[model samples]
Target: MNFLADLLDLILPEHCAGCGLAPVLLCDACALPLQGPARPARTAPEGLPPPWTVTTYEGPLRAILAAYKEHGRTALAAPLGEALATAVKAALTPHHLPTTREAHRGHDPPSLVWVPSRRLATRRRGHDALRGLVDVAAQRLRTTGVPVICVDALRQRGRVADQAALTARERTTNLAGALDVTSPTQIAGRPVVLVDDVVTTGASLAEAARSLRKAGADLLGTATIAATPRHHPA
Candidate 1:
């Protein structure tokens, strides 16, 4: 597969998802925004875990994510997953720096439960992009001694329409009762951080959180790569 990919890359040189630079999946200049401090998502829904995001869903970050998700540019997952890992680390224990004792003693961190995208969408896309992001992020986190585990705990209960055209309220309505916890035994009494690639109205995350809580998991907030920025009252 590596040989095939390399041959394909040489034949059809890949352009940076952010800039048009050749051979790089995402360039450093475009990655600067992704490395910026994680911030609260703008339009969080009630019952949604407190959200942490790396950047706004605009410009190069948006383009990169769209290319990875919509266009099946799976090679971009490494850079994008690194960004998500940074956000997860920032949100994990904001004030308390990890002690050398804890780091060396091998304290287990909470599980990261990724909210699976809609089944229909994943079927059409031929891959689960969010799951890929979670897998890579978990690997990076473990390398940093975070002891994170990735689990696919939630499943879509039914088909739902695309949320791009829906209002925030409509999104909430559409996602209500739309997620189910697949393994209560695995999640029960476990601390979990919900993860997603992008957050718009946060309806999907909220629904996933509800399912987790119902199944006895301790919900510990959320981390995402980007969020749709919200307007504040002047």
Candidate 2:
């Protein structure tokens, strides 16, 4: 199934993933919104740096993400991943003594860890969506000379109901204690940024953060491609 999906990605996809306008995977105009000066997320809980996002999870961005995640439009990973790369860079800039990657060379570069999806979800989709995006995001950063490490450090412990219909409080409860670090050695004492595809109520990021901190990660902040509209305000 995965092989067939990859084959289809190359042969199919005649329209832009974001706007469906034509001949390219993503048109520049549609990619504009993903380019952001990442801002503090409105839903950030106390004690964690706000997860910075590039755009609101709506319109073209939403469509593109859905296509890539749920529908197997794997080709869309390039643009979305690059957008995630931008968000990651922005999220770390302010905290560094100097803004450029060159300046941070002396110290160990931060690790980018993503929220792990459930095994059931991965099986249903035949793909681990967010992990693919994070891999690309890290690659995009590396091509531009950023020193970084991408780690698949978190793992889900047990089943939880689908988050699609959950309210903010319910989401928090459902995900509480649902994730754990697979290897503390990979994250311990290192500055880390949590990555995700979207931020709805921030329940996932908060839970991920909790596990990473417990494992001894510095927990620089969180970064995502987009966030719910209410969290992305004007």
Candidate 3:
């Protein structure tokens, strides 16, 4: 670890995000609570595509994920990325899901695409937060021969309110016309997995899915590191 990272870790002190065990951000015992193999998560608006989460975004998991996104805890990205890979593997297992799951997984492994960060946020944050998890996830998926390819499929066209603080309808409006596909050919021939960090309203992924489909891509599903299980509009 770099001095800065070491300093950060020192100041914050690394503890298991779940159970507070030292020497690792996520200890085996804490990770053990995640049941079963990875599988596709049931998202609303049926017929769109299958979506997946490595584990429920609740309790200790929620704290860990929120730290990475909203609280500037970038070091946790690797673990979250691994969790996402686990979710993708579950999504791939036909037995774990309903019979229709085969229809999505049998052919080609979907190319993974992160919901392109808004230019403003990229500048403000100085790093593509979601990209870290996406890249590591692709690396993890490689172990199973699932091809996770990153393509600059979506581009943010303009400014939008923070999805975290917005109403669901506002989020939809904020993301309207926000993305454009520059290379449809790559995604057109295979399924594309829309990726992001948090899935509060899911407006971001939903819109990205819409844009990808409009560009003629067959989307397998979406995946994220953290998904707010319930929608309580603030």
Quote model 2's TM-score: 0.87
Model 1 TM-score on a 0 to 1 scale: 0.86
How high is the lDDT of residue 52 in model 1?
88
By lDDT: ranked, best first = 2, 1, 3
Q: After superposing candidate 2 on the true structure, give the runs of residues whose Cα lies further than 4 Å from its correct spot.
A: 1-13, 97-107, 231-234
State model 1's lDDT: 0.82
Alpha-carbon TM-score of each model against the true structure: 0.86, 0.87, 0.76
Better of 1 and 2 by lDDT: 2
List model 1 lDDT by residue over 1-234, tens digit each.
245644665678787888768567778888788778787777678777568888888888877887787677898888888878987877787534344357467644578998888777788777999899988988988887676778889998888888989998999899999999998988888778899988998898898889999999977779999988777899
Expressed as tens digits, the lDDT of each residue in 134-155 for candidate 3 is 8888897776556556676888
lDDT of 2 by residue, 101-152 (tens): 5546566677999999989889988899988999899898877766677899
Question: Residue 19, candidate 1: how far off, in angstroms?
Answer: 2.8
